[model samples]
Target chain A: MERLLFDLSIAIERGKENETSPYPPDLKGKPGAYEFTSRLLEMNCPPDTILKQGMMPGMDRIGKKFADGIVFIPEILIAAKAMKAAMTLLKPYFDNGAVLRKGKVIIGTVAGDLHDIGKNIVCMVLEGAGWEVFDLGVDVTKEKFLASLNEHPESIICMSALLTTTMREMEKSVTTIKQAFPQTKIYLGGAPLTSDFADKIGADGYFPDPHSLSKHLTGNL
Target chain B: MINKTFRFSTESLLPDISLILIEMGYSIPLADHYLSDLINDTLQQVRKHTRVQAGFIMLPKDSIKTQSNILFENRLLFEPGSIIMSQLQNVTSLAVFLATLGSDFDLWIKFVQQIDMLQAFVIDTIGSLMVEKAVDLLEEQISMQAMIRAEKCTNRFSPGYCQWLVDEQHQLFHLLPADFDWVKLQPSCLMTPLKSISGIIGLGKNVIKIPYHCAFCDNKSCYRRLKNRKGQ
Candidate 1:
């Protein structure tokens, strides 16, 4: 069982989806995360164990590689693809309360900013790292964020803005959300964002990439 | 001279898969079959689905004024900075331009995101490259038009780049014709289609186009920084 779990982790880290998935040439035609996850479930393995051992390790490895710059966006994306394949099989378990996620994350692009690729990437990484994420989509107002937080209290708030012009909107939204929920932790990311900018906006954290945010959320930073 | 507009089909842009791959951080030789297929498929989708639109208006030689940090035209000013100002110093004229892949391209990306995240990313990257290619064509056209008058083109600079405050986009939009609706700038000054590029290019005998030096900028999350680092 341990060996199978380890193999599942490798499959995910290498971005092997299944026997037919041709990515990562060396892993082509090998049993992938999909198959490994199915087999683990058939063996009556606990859903939490499969997720914590088999999946989280893979996400952690890829996230570290991303932070270290050993890997790029495509690699992280493919790893995310594999992780999604596994997650699809584990959804029922998650829905039935057989597994517990680390925490909830509410992510969105601030108002006047239509960009979502960076935000989506963070959503995938956070979900892969065992967080339940509520994506509020593009051009989200502070009111929308507050409403979402009202639905999922104690959730970490993450905002993305790709344009410097829209950074003002982000600052406004952050201020409003913080005022409404003083205990909420707000994180910011995007091409034009920096830790200094986050600090100036009273955000709890800023990550240049999704992996750093994941690391921080997991308390590994 | 009247302001001009040009619309291009994807065929004219000649999207370069290899160049896009390089920008996506993949070496040509290392772009394996999967990546190659992925890029090719996305390119096809982009060609079939994207609406590549670009337009530019020329400001004649004497109508423009410049200070150390301000580009003054039509009694409006944009503070791009010392670096951009220095680059624009020798221009006899300026071309204010806008380019976009239109909203359909964005719709396709949003649709793909619901199904495949990696493919959606590829589509998004390709969409960006396509808009840039469209802008490149517009710049070349402006340069060609300038060449007829014995003028050369300087490297293009956008409001959100090279120390230019993004808020200046509002000022840049004001320079366009009132009827110009190819791209709409939001109240925040970001374009509506979201995958749009707007900027100015200088044309003159002494305005030489040089490689963009990312080292002088401090936008650490700038993808150009990664591309530059990769080149090193």
Candidate 2:
């Protein structure tokens, strides 16, 4: 049973989806995450164990590789793909309180920046790391962020923007939100921002990559 | 926004994952083959579903200045205000433009949600690459047009680059021809295609040579800036 869990982790790390998935050719005909996860559940393995042991570690390994530049976005994407496949079967258990989330986060792209890849990647990494993320979609305004923040006061607020154009919006949103909820910790992520910018914006943290953000979520930041 | 029916050009370039990875600081040889294949597959999927359209209009040089969110035909008015775009003293004209990978890409992203999130991410990255390529193509074509006028073109500068504010995006979009179905801009300046871009290009003789694009920006962790700093 332990070996099966290990196999599940390996399959996820390799991005092998199932027997028919052409990815990682060596695992081509072998059972992928889908098959392994189903089998593990059938074995009466605890849902949390499958997630913590099987998916999280696999995602954690890849997440580290990704942050260190040992892996690229595509590899991260595939790994995320595999992990999500397994997570789908585990969702019911999670919803039923059989498993507990690491924490919760409210994240979005600040208004005027319609980009979402960065947000999507960050959310995926966070969720894989065991956080429940409330994703506020693109062009999200400051009011929207405040609304979500008010509703999920326990959730960390993470804002993202891809363009320098929208940095002002990010700054504006942060300033307003910080003033209104000075106790709420805010984090900023984007392609055109720096730690200095985060400091300037009065943010609690600046995650250079989703891995670091995950670490922050895990209290490692 | 300067309205005009001036001539321009449009083109598209597919994303190259190998090169994209290199930009992300991964040497070509160090790139994972499986990952490369997956990104390429995602690009192909986006390409299959994408309808790319990008074009730029070359407005004749005018007295350009800005005041109260308005360019005085010669003023360097910033979108969010107080950004010196650059030395446009000799900028005889501006190439206002728009580019998009189309709504199909948006539909594809939404569709991928029910399928796979990772693939969706890849597709999203591909769309961004497409928009960049489209802008690159637009700038190149604009440069050629400048050459025909016996003028040199400054490196393309968008509404939010350097000192320009993103708030100026709507102003630039209003200059494109009516019925320009390719891309649409919102009151907030967000483009519809999600992978769309709109900005200005300086065309002239001896327009100020731009310093490295990194000098004026704050995103110190950008891969482009990182690669540039590493002397790549």
Per-residue lDDT tens digits for candidate 2, residues A1-221, read: 89989999888888887778877767778899989999999999999999989888888888888888777766776777787778899999989999999878899998877777678878887887888999998889999999888898877899998777677788899998988888888999987788898998789888878988888778743
What fraction of the reference structure's interface contacts does model 1 contain? 0.81
Best by lDDT: 1
Superposing all C-alpha atoms, what RMSD in Å does each candidate have to the true structure? 2.3, 4.3
Q: lDDT for every model?
A: 0.83, 0.74
Candidate 1: where are CA atoms >4 Å away?
Answer: B27-33, B69-74, B177-180, B205-211, B215-218
- CAPRI quality level assigned to candidate 2 from its DockQ score: acceptable
Q: How many backbone clashes does every candidate have?
A: 0, 10
Evaluate chain B of model 1: give its TM-score. 0.89
RMSD (CA, Å), candidate 1 to true, equals 2.3
